[model samples]
Target chain A: MMADAKKIVQVLFEANNIPIPPNRAAIFEQFIKKPGSEAVIRALLANQTELMEKWKLENRIMDIAQQPVRILNATVGKPYETWFDFDQLKWKDIAAFEFTGLEDIGLTFDPKTSQLSGVPAQSGDYKLLFRYRLQEEPEDAPYHEKVIPIIINPDPKSLWKKLDSNQQDPYWKEDDVTAFEPLGDRSILVSSKRGRSHANVGSFREDDFAFKALPGGWNIVVVADGAGSAKISRKGSALACNTVVEYFLDQPAVEGMAVFDELLKQYKTDNSEIQKKINQHVYNNLGKAALHVHKKLIAFAAEVSVPVKDLNTTLIFTLFKKYETGYALLSFGVGDCPIALLNKDVSEVTLMNWIDVGEFGGGTRFITMPEIFHDQKFATRFGFKVVEDFSYLIMMSDGIYDAKFVVEANLPNIKKWKEFLADLGGKNEDGISVALSTANPDIVSQFSAWMDFWSPGNHDDRTLAIVF
Target chain B: MRRLPVYLLLDTSGSMTGEPIEAVKNGVQVMISSLRQNPQAIETAFISIISFDSTAKQLVPLTDLASFQMVDIKASGTTNLGEALHLVATSIDNEVAKTTADQKGDWKPLVFIMTDGIPTDDWQKGLEEFKKRKTAYTVACAAGSNADTNVLKQITDNVVSLDTADSQSIAKFFTWVTASIGVTSTRVEDAGKEVTGLSELPPPPAELNIVV
Candidate 1:
């Protein structure tokens, strides 16, 4: 029986062209000494063909199972090209391949060569479904389908070029504020300064701010804090701030006011219902704007041949308009940047869009992050306020708040924040009011210096933009 | 946003007394000083330290690298590797934030274990528990000739051996650790990836060797 078992093993190895290693041969000899070895050998030989077939099937499935179609991102009005190749699928026996779901998006797919390529006509999410089957499988064999998502974005090359040119200028100093100037009667002060740590290392400031006076007393202010870890965050923050302001400035006055009017129409009749409607509309508009910035960053990265993640920054902006009834403030934020509305007396401060660090400490969402689309809460938050009288609106990066208001590395309540502001503003309740109302050029220097105030461990680039 | 958590498990048995323990302390300080220069590490790295002797104790809780301060370690008693492993498992379960439907969680932790003596307690069960929550990277260092390389191999594939626990050798080990961490932090920031293996580790000075 032992000799027969040995002979069977040799024949199996020979037929498969497999070498019997000395160690494996010794183990095989030891196995033959066990009881019932003859029955085991017989069963093994009888089932060898079936096992081999099963193994081949499993290996084929594994080869084809995780052949992922890379999700392609493209900008609207831009020529985009991408292909799905059968080579990556690694299924040699595939009899046929079929593609669906591209017709609606105006994309072309060739199943003969498993190629898909086209420019998406619109800006949104799309799924391309692909199905394939094996040639040797039964007529009723189950076909496998893969759904790949394609994201179409708005064109940002022109905007990105505008931003990139600014970044590349050798005349621009590393410590210079990105943009700071009073627009009109409404004193808009924007200032950004390099953090102490960044200065020590001679690194460029990653914070940026932009503001422009829109037609009809409407003002748009944007502040962006670039992620410290991102290599090109300086460019990211500059692009974010500029892109948001540009978007608001380019919008037709009527259309921009239409959003405010919708909120005003719903404002007091059914406060809760109106708030809900306003929140939804504001979220949609702001989310759209944020998505535009994200797409622009992606497009810019593609044009420059850099990873989009290098250009990650948090965005916060407010579009303020004065109406007969009162003033309407529409603010949106992604990440840890804060936007606040101060009462007429400057005694009370209300955080328009409040953001806390995510579940994990030291982590915040960026406009360019893919996760922003998956989770709406992290994508953007909108706050709408219609006030009869207010001192001014203040928007700032976390650097300012982390130093002054944050308690034990946690976000402080509105009451605590008001107190902190009062302290920074000094004994007079009018300190912040005076600072915002001042038209003097020194105010920019003062604000820039104020950001450098001593803080134990909070040393990040500081940016503050005030719309009065 | 998520932070990169790093854990250091040090054996504080009597075998690590005198200059060896002092070198460990200085090494930690060197790591802190070096990491402070890296803005990415300063922004994303969180650190914790655990020490084991007759019993195990968490010497430091998970704290941001910016605020981390080296705590002096005192060596005494037998090597209780089992207790240290159990403590690390518990701390990870308790301290590491988890992802939710609305927000992401912290990155997987990087763990380093340094021991100069064999365990005086049963360590298999504790190791099993820790492995169930496998860290992104786990590197074990056998600090002296008397240390057991075979047991360390069971814990992690990335293991190194130090010929002696002298101050210079320990300093070299810590410098390598700091460099590894610095590279990891940059990778996380630049590529948004949590590296699970050390493809390029700093070469060990003459006193140390890779344990295969």
Candidate 2:
């Protein structure tokens, strides 16, 4: 350890900045023996601050400097303070800046007042800049003192609006389709309930296999993923997944494959309109949202408003259908998650050739690109499969990749996959958020983890689905 | 080696009651955030607060700025420059000087004294004490409107006179302070000297209009 430290420190130190003592080896040995010790033995030191500092630093409580603890003042509005006497403030106020990391620190400007200070466990230099936005281009601060940094984190969620019901599930509505006839009776029956718990991934299986009463020789299945970025990718994914399985299962046995073709045509037609709506939504709304936020930010800056940045996000999905001869399907993903069809026997997972229909990630909606309307169908790039018989199917939204699931094809053990999910639950919450939040903190291993080293890793949200 | 004792001797006199006080308050938070971001600054900087209104008051005793809570200062009285100055001197003489290896302290003490009004009380005694102490750290003065420039000049070679802190000048002043401190920190490590800059523009000819 001592030798390692000598090598590390010697390599990093600036030449001629400070002399590296010869006996530093001994000092490093002492350091490694008692890690985090700031003590420098006089015998192993070059001239710097007096040796006494070495002793003082050794006993210092924390390594970094700490800002003084301040008893910040809050704005006063004791309920019945003052009515605007021709608009004159009667109470004292301080702009309580929002501090991050510290729990329960709230910053409020009651009906227009300054911020109040709250208890912060950690302290250091904080910027205390407060700016006032004016109607006009209002002059810049005489100098650039405009950016006042507070020494401590001021809590921003002072008004943590009751987690709005607006915590919306405003994405593709993928509901289970339940229209299959009884295969077990071999004769006739009524409703059949899908036994969903048993599967590779706990999603609804194709009609019969999902049913317990099915004494069938074999069963069928389907898997799908939803794109989260494009305005309507989720809708397209759900529409495709739900419709494909339902159409086949509901059809009379003789008309099964024929019915599937009609459903596909209808899907293509509906998808075209949906795509148009989505394109318009992005072009109309996204630009406006950015403009609104940017204007607010600029005003905030001009008034020395808040020094906070805004956030934006993306999406992806897949869809497939099951049949007696094995599932026949058309799947299309606009942005990232690549798709593949593997043989159910676990023998071969084929990477189907598919066109790259959508532009890559960078919040764009294709306002205008000519000669590519009918020529550039969103579902132009697609993969289809027909097998003699199959056991399982899989689809995902790159989140599985975080666990090192290969995009084109890689069959991870079910148990290993479950463990990966558990690791995910341990690291983050469930739902689509696993998409954006999968960027791991491991710096060393991250570079090698991705196919695109330039991107470091897939930042777009992730979704993974498997069926059996 | 003791930690550098940084005394923020602010003027809370009546003249500095409104915008001035607010700006100072805002500036302090900015400076605190700045220091906290710097690995070396936070470890070495210990801040003491002394606000002078009717009489100089020690709102907060010697503590690291990281831990120092900013008091909502109200400026409603006379400027006790003399008392505040004396307090700073005594603080250095008794508290800072006594810091040692056993005590866990810093190097040369630093005082960032800012004021906007004339001194009505006797500051001569405090000046004498200041002169007597062996110079170790640094003393910087941010002069405000109506501040006695001569009085600030007496205490330190480094002085930044701020004209009326109208709405526009806040960012410029703070930026200068940040730049100066950053450069000063670098210089401290490189040249081993306290680097100080007057409130001026980038070069000599184009001075930033900080002073009236």
Candidate 3:
């Protein structure tokens, strides 16, 4: 801190907003003639700056002291830069500006540009005390001090905790699962991962999925999302998915599908007579599977001595059969999850099931709700779609739907579906794509990693099954 | 981004001049600091403040947690709660984003009204105006025995009462408010639902009791 008489005088004159006289050289000489040492001169300059601040506040020349300070925003680990834009204050007319609290947050203030710029290392609210001298004020005018608040926000991703779920529980399920299976002409890639919200508190992943290749060129894909508030929804979701897949795997259900195959062939030729029979047959088969799940969940709840509502979960499944003409997709859903099929040209999407959303506001009807079984509209939850050819068929829990599509109306939107497909192809925040081709050896891991992509306020267990 | 809007309606009548007013300011400062540390609240919660004295005015517009600042307020004059409620309804209409077919909107606003005195104006008119707007939840606090809990009950079913309008009790109330906001922010995504009453909020401290 070297003290220069000429520098001090020049600063004082600029702070007073007055041009220096022609004899400025003589004025500087006279100003410091009586000073003893550098320390004393430096002390005198510091004292002047303080006095100027006091004088400015006392006069109320500006309302900076009387009003709330302007607040600036920043994020931890992100660069922050902003200029001083105070009301009724002219930047050029101020001189000898200084700032406090910048050093504590690893920020620096450059007086030349009057800008504060740096990367904040912490998250919190900080009030900066700014002291300055007005160029237009008298030499005896005190320096002005104004308070400005800067808030640094924490990175949402950084705040996430990733503790493993408890393995000691009797109904404990694995935190994550991924699979890549080959099905006749198409391949199925599935991934289910615990969301950040669940991982934050070491909670179980309440999503489950199951897929199986039936004997007669047919495939079944089931996905279930357990209610977050439900106590044992993890087991309920597992039972909901496994029960349906196993039902189709059993001898009776297999024979029933064989009957369905026969009915489909006859219905293709004779429209009216066989069409009615085919509808009845498809409904009976899917309905039986759903009932099996509902009954099994109730039994499981009783065995565990817990309320059935504790096992609440959303269930969606599709049984699609391939034929020389096209593909027949029969779907049933009892909740908010969606099953979608995209056409070969990617211009159209068929949402295969009636969604139980919007009507209840934010509540999703679950398979565990016994009252729905008696509703006549429950039969309408079953849907049938026949597509000539398709690019992809997908089934997902609300964890994925809420983040990707947001609402039920978006399920049938071709544009949203296209964007979602692009997102799967790696156009996401993480740039981790699930290559549709089976040739990609790391497809399963890639898909699982993609599930970890961050969407603020949308962390829930995710289960996605894609067929392409 | 869809935000969780929080409205704080504070009564700044003449009775709150000394320790009560200072406590209210400190309580708010503490609440802001605590919410910033919560991952759920930090990501979604946006806060606004309305202060009512002889008349009501919005002290701060809706601001995110990071940029929020507390301004000093001087307590004086009679309580005009009716004006405050009208301002809240209008601020919500102007500030909150409504969900539509095209875009996702903000979560329903959460309102907390704290007052130590009865309204000197026609509060029913303001209540009528406020009823037209939808909120996820509204909790009214009777700051002391002087406050009319019956009146607060008419404003909202979720009403709580405190023995005194002192620093300790008010501070505890704000802590409970902070916890309520934290839980609601997470619940919105965790269950894909909204909070509608005190049952959904955290339990109040010993200093506060349920009005009902």
Candidate 4:
């Protein structure tokens, strides 16, 4: 605390650019023992008034540097207090400490203890100018000053800004959408919500979906995730889903389904030749619908006078048919989304579609790309799954898939699927869950609310569809 | 969780001893404080610092904004940019998560390099190694006229030049960097997309000029 007279003199001498003389400590001790020693020291420095002023100004920085460095931090509306330890300063018998910067932050300072205390009213960096005077100094003496850095961090939760998207735009859609429709003996529920990230920036939710009950006990559900990098991807996604669903509502689709039913029954009897026929029939019908979607997007892009790339989006859908013996689930995907089916006991989970994640280092294959048709793996993208009875058939965009499954491989993991279902059953941080039951009329809204769960960095637009 | 990893490569050579070094320190402090106010950056951005002088050192490892602390750094010795680049590349491999069956990797890292002088070692070797690793964007800044922009050009196409290494210019650069990080964090969270070009970033302040 600079209690020794020798130490105080040495620091002052060094700051004033005065060369230290030999035996200076002994001289200082001898001088302090004499009466009027303070006056004597002051008189010696009186000739160099400029140096004394410089020392006073420089002492503040030196004092702060000599003390242990630590950031003084506070949060808005949070209580905070920090004491200025003046022991490092060379000034002896220090008195009359005052701080000038506390008023800006609505803090109070006690001159006796040299402490600043109060709740910070704002968030910002504050430099407190600490002023102090020597005990023997006159009332008109200049106060020594020190600049201390103080930071006030903001409450993160309050920083988020939610603004509405422009509805006047031609291709604008609602921030959220939900649907419930009966599909033969079963029903499908779908929910899609704009992510918080989008809501914060007033951007559109670039995800869309469509589900319909078709003839011949067939149900079709299609989901699309518009490319975030693309300009009009929302329109592309909407067109992709609608074109596929509109195709299935035609008579040609019914005829195609009839041919598939015949091939399915034949394949059950004979495994080799009939199985190949079943594959060809499913491709001819469902695959045709996918190709037609691509064609429709191109036409729309040309009609809208924008590049086809501007309308980039991903497409995934399932064609479900309920047979007396078992259920047939034929699915196709051309993006990072996942389609999965769970057994009744929830012990087994089967991935029903191909995903394009991590293929080209996190680049997804959009349905709008023409090269996908020529790619060798395009034929393998469609899959057929036959199960005795399943608990849930879930299909979602990358938003939900990336958040729940993380990577493509986890899409088929039994444990991950179980945990995902549990999250749907009220195991999430938000404590919002949706039951897969037709008895609950608010199932759609419930699913929408559940989509608002916080997942740190995964806030892309979420779209989920379940056939239960 | 996908983190928006940011790597800062700063030059602490002998020439940066006085005003430049102190400006750099203040720049980083201000950057950290400003980023803390951003909800998206607070949630996703993780930062690391690599300082290069006679040798390179990772002053800070990959740390989230909530707990990131800046250690004191002094300027001395020659500029060893090669070692700094190599260290950053190795650190990215060791620290960044990769997308596998087990986990989702962080978004491609964002790299920012600032220097006031030319390299004293064969930096091309480090560049070769750096090219193998993927990053969302790498922006290099040549502070003052002594900083060779051509050398930085070899490191990245996104290069900016500052007239001087004073506190005001450094502060403006740091503010631009903070805005860039905020834009990126929000972009990934909202768009599920990565920024691959300089056009995607916010324009630099008047104190900084693009080194085309």
Candidate 5:
């Protein structure tokens, strides 16, 4: 790496609203020298030109000190950081506005460092977002780029009129099946903020977590994440969430989690008797639809022909059935995720780290496939459980785990607790309030201290389900 | 898993003036959003929108469905079905070239060309270009009220009539397209699950009769 080129890199960061965090700019310079180096380096460029031309998105980095920096999207108006840490994702006054041509939007902050530069390409008025994770202190810099709105196409009024011109899909206004609903016995709290940072995209208020009443003296709390990258992921997540809950509710009132747990196990075992049946059923119901897509994509690949629809995305979800004896939380979906409990009323019974099943090793895998879903052993197992009224149970996707290298890591970072979570990894937070009411430090502080929880990079959507 | 690329070649010509064009436009957006919503639809279906009037233009370029944006198209100019067909074929050729021995990409390109007026440009060159079209794509032309089914047949032996380009017919075309796309992508996704790919596809929709 040349000396001046490195300094210019610093200027790049400074220009983009981020400082050349200590050793990071240097590492970035060296890293971008490989064969696909151009692509790597372009991601680091200050503007959206590189992103626009390459179709690569803007990214957010958590800790430069970490080996591999976590990256998120940069196309939206407000970065994912803004969503993750809205209050801190503030900007200086210039004008009230929005960005355009972007899709997903998010934002978060680093109280440890208090910096913000996330997914959104531009901001409301004029202010570029920036973070100094590795710097001694971000405020060390005298000035920051006030991110400004850029409208390459100003015909927005017309565009909006056309969009609302009564010539749209009936489903256009409906929460596209995968919209969020409430989960657990908890009352839902909903909020909103400008999403996608696009001028056209107004402030969005959505609640993707939901809970429904069940017949058998049980309350069902469900959290399902549509594959952010897959086409029908949203639909798949909706189907899985709706189907699982419906199936369980249909069964006769099972007294306890243990009872329901056993029935679930049996149902899964019975699934094998119809493995062929499940396979054929999946093919019969979803085959033609799936094949229709498969052929077009292959055709797209073959250049024989193609369509304008996208079909790649992944999903992660859970269904919690609250029974008298410890509620049973049944979770099955593609991709690995975070599952844990947090207690608000008392100090104990909150395990933010995932509770483990003695034999379960949860990294990341495709649980949406028919083979996996039909696997009685894997599918029927109640990987985690929750008893008591407690605060809430949190389950997040690879967005956080991937950024934290948590496949093998645990929460509230400490030796005793680490070993404890690893043992209770799959079911760490699923137990009853029978204990933990004895501990100190309230639930708010528990969250207050866990600052690095928002995954570093902003590549995928962040979904956190709080089942209280 | 292999994806089935479905190209929506829409006619944005000035002639698509009133209800028919609006219906077509609304129908396209509905289909895109619907496919995204249908758990039964996304196994491997991907879409691309190509609009043609005087010049064939790729409105939403060839990208995965998850990434492609559905832009608002304004009606203008003369019908250049030939030019659009040529461009679609050319785009397919270029994209297919990127496939390697290590991975099998899109199954087969499904080109749905929707037009009302006759081609104002030379379509023979496109017909010739498609003749050399490796069986990589299964081309299906849908004719509207005044559409040139004959010209469509020349491009691909099979031509589908979208009747009046009315909401109903547009819906029918989208259903067939969605069904066709889903089948192609699903077969490809399920294929990797086994040692052998599925033997064959059920014939296209009943209304989508194959032309000899």
Candidate 6:
């Protein structure tokens, strides 16, 4: 057995091109004395081909454990809760898990359980390395390592407060339903309310509406619905509505006329052509106003150290010019808010521009979404109605429409909705249309309170602005 | 106001008689109590309980969560899963309002089914018919080893399995259900859309396995 061991050792040294040391014999002698050492040497020599095949199998098995760990990006100062459970990550065979590179990031990773939790202390990009090995492998076993990029963003909640302190007020209060100011005897009624469900949860109202009466009989009305999934959507909606109204009020009357002049040049010299030009002008101005609001929102987001998308919201506005012949209604909107123009007889109800929705139901384009400027369907398409016989112009967020107006085809039935509104705006004992026609000081309170009407399955912040 | 309708289809087969049945009853109560605390659920979610044994019965009609009361569920006879599906379909049709030219109707309904054993009656046809309706989300749970996962998969991709019908596992399952309801209710109210499918379901406990 000793001779066999010596011969095997000599062959191994020669095959590896290694010169034998003076202590080689002693090492061989020590190895031979160990139990099972001779048997191991014999087995290797007898089955070199089989041993090589087994080594290849082991390599393949190790490759199976080389999957990259996926960790979602985090936001600073928000509860950063994430789990890296072995079972959840499909690493059932993992025996040891180690995390590195999180020491300075204010995050915690449990090596024993692979649980990660922390509110990021700062906002920056970081790379965290995670290493894991198979259950049967030794502590010193080769581990598969994954480098995951972690991005922490500044929390928008604090930044939003810093940018606009007055926003803290409950603007959706039932008594404060009127716009910042009245629009003369035009009988403008504005209502905003936190949906019953949102109110129940103590969440702030996400819908906002504001109207500004421009010089020369131009009325600018804006409505914005903040993205619910966005943590600071309420702020986004408020900022959008206020910014657009302010932009229009600051602009000279010629810029508004330039919107019409640009369209007038494109048409033939005729009365219908004039009307068409007027409609085009209204559409262009509203679209431009929306674009201005988007740019301002992006700038505000940067000032507050937040992603522009965090202030995601839908913008719908109208620049109305009432003429002696009739009222020229120009409306522009991005997202799912509804705008309808009702004729004097109330028989013909026309939905200005239908709500824009993506392939997936809830995916609606917002002003903060850059794609809105590129998508012609949402950007260029504005609701421009040059009507001589219109009585009331109604605009509302999806919160009010989705309750009783949603249909299978996705398009809202305007005729049916008009009837529902007529019922809500019933006649008074004096035979006057008290809700729709009259200018009552309590109209804001009544409209805001009326939105609380119970309907099964619809609990969203409601906003409605009517120009009669 | 459009209320989110949530239906719970429970199994009361003979196999679920003793501790399993009692645990299920307690689990349901836990769910109701948890939902009541969630403002979103309280404002929008409407609860209904349907139990199936040898026959399927509507133990509670669609009622607001604030008024929802837990009833004693008694175990009996074979698992008539087919009847339960039919009852759910019929109940939604009869109770849920449809959007017409005049006004909007209720949002899509959410359904959850929990069972401990294989169905004794034909459930395939009923399940297919139920799928034809506009449903927001659907989840089916196999409560014990005897429950057929293959059959449950046909009803919904969101399927969970419980290794044993112990009190702890049952309680955990109900907790998960409550969390799911809270999430859906919030989405509906916030987004003004009928969001379907499971996006953020609470992870199942140790005794429970999510069926991929």
Q: Largest TM-score belongs to which candidate?
A: 3
**RMSD of candidate 2 to the true fold?**
28.2
Residue A387, model 1: Cα distance from true site in angstroms = 0.8
Residue range A106-154, candidate 1, lDDT tens digits: 6787655455667666655566776767776676777777676565543
lDDT of 5 at A294: 30
Across residues A1-468, which tens digit of lDDT does each residue of candidate 5 receive?
Answer: 345445555677689997656668567767546557555445555354545543321122222112122223233332243232323343222122233223322343444444434454432212224323212224344332222222111111122211121214321212311223344444322111111111122211111234465565455544444433344343344344455455445533233223544454333334666444433333332223223323333344235222222222233334456555545454433344545554544344433223221111222333244344355543332344444454655555443333343333344334433343342222233231111121323433332223112221122333444444
> Which of candidates 1 and 2 reaches a greater DockQ?
2
- TM-score of each candidate? 0.59, 0.32, 0.87, 0.79, 0.34, 0.61
- Between candidates 2 and 4, the one scoring higher on lDDT is 4
| Residue-wise C-alpha lDDT for candidate 2, range B14-103, written one tens digit per residue | 887678778878877667667555434444456778888789888777776345566678878887888887887777776674433223
Q: Per-model C-alpha lDDT, please?
A: 0.73, 0.42, 0.86, 0.84, 0.45, 0.73
- Model 2 agreement with the true structure over A1-468: per-residue lDDT tens digits: 355445544554636365457778577556545644323322233433446665554333122112232333222122112111212321122122222332322232333443343345343333443333222222442211123333443222221122211214544232222222333212111111111111112222111112222111212232223322223333333333333344334434214334444444333334777445433433332233223323432343345332222111111222244444444443433333444454554555544323232211222222121222234553343444445554434444333342344322233234434444344333333221122122334421221122111111122223333333
In model 6, what lDDT does residue A228 have? 77
List the candidates ranked by TM-score, beginning with the highest: 3, 4, 6, 1, 5, 2
Deviation of model 4 at A6, angstroms: 19
Per-prediction DockQ comes to 0.02, 0.03, 0.54, 0.49, 0.03, 0.13
Best by DockQ: 3
Worst 10 residues of 1 chain A by lDDT: A156-165
Indicate the fraction of true inter-chain contacts that candidate 6 also forms: 0.35
Task: Report residue A98 deviation for candidate 4 (angstroms).
Answer: 16
Candidate 4 at A386: error in angstroms?
Answer: 2.8
Better of 3 and 5 by lDDT: 3
For residues A10-113, what per-residue lDDT tens digits would candidate 3 score against the true structure?
68668999667777756656656655645567787799878987686456547545556564778888888987664344455565568988989878988667
**Which digits, one per residue and each the tens of the lDDT, describe model 6 over residues B95-173?**
8877554344667898999999999998987787788777888989999788999999989988999998888888888
**In model 3, which regions exceed 4 Å deviation?**
A1-68, A86-92, A136-147, A359-362
lDDT of 3 at A402: 79
